[model samples]
Target: MGKPYRECPHCGAHLDAGERCDCGEPEQQEQTAAEERPRMRLIAVCREVDKDTGRIAVICL
Candidate 1:
């Protein structure tokens, strides 16, 4: 299951893939001003590596 989505906490509008809410709400002023957001990192995984050579199925997201 995925996390339940909710309306925008700032202006009660809605949030997409954007940082700011739909409206020009500044409710997150304290949060943004007080702390800094970190960039998301993608990690890959190797399913199986070749025994003879050096090959693997690197899965990425």
Candidate 2:
């Protein structure tokens, strides 16, 4: 089965999974914050906020 998914930075409106936002985005854009994620916690989606600095959080699989 496919994995449960989250929204694309371009696609997700209310923060849900999708390939592209209805408003549209550039192809150069990468996957959503979730897809780029290495993994999610077993129970919950990790909450992270980055204002500046190096990669804030580079998810390592």
Candidate 3:
């Protein structure tokens, strides 16, 4: 039988006995949080007035 095999945690590479893994390499860790900014757009605004001369608006998208 071949040497025991195990799956690498970082790159998912199959590792065998006496093999080295680059899971701790800097390049691989850099892209983990690559500024995945979200995109949003303003939808609409609603306004209402009361007898006390107050204004309230509810925004909805």
Candidate 4:
């Protein structure tokens, strides 16, 4: 017989009972937010430039 296991909701990793996944932890969340901040700021800047130039700015992500 095998022991039962469960899936981690944040990362879909298999975990034993009473175990927790770090994927949803604050540290990882903060890192993700930090990574996204620059991209968002770039988009905002591009929008402002486009408005001033009267042309669509294409951002390749």
TM-score of each: 0.30, 0.18, 0.30, 0.35
Q: Model 4, range 1-61, lDDT digits (tens) per residue?
A: 8759889876889998898887776797778878887553343334334567688666644
Which is better, 1 or 2, measured by lDDT?
1
Candidate 2 Cα misplacement greater than 4 A, ranges: 1-22, 27-32, 43-61
* Model 4 RMSD in angstroms: 9.4
What TM-score, to 2 decimals, does candidate 4 have? 0.35
lDDT of each: 0.68, 0.53, 0.71, 0.71
Show model 1 residue runs off by greater than 4 Å: 1-37
Model 2 gets an lDDT of 0.53
Candidate 1, residue 3: lDDT: 37
Task: Compose the digit string of candidate 3's lDDT tens values, residues 1-61.
Answer: 8547887887889888768787767774556555454556787776565658676666687
Error of 1 at 32 (Å): 10
Q: How many Å off is the CA of 4 in candidate 1? A: 58
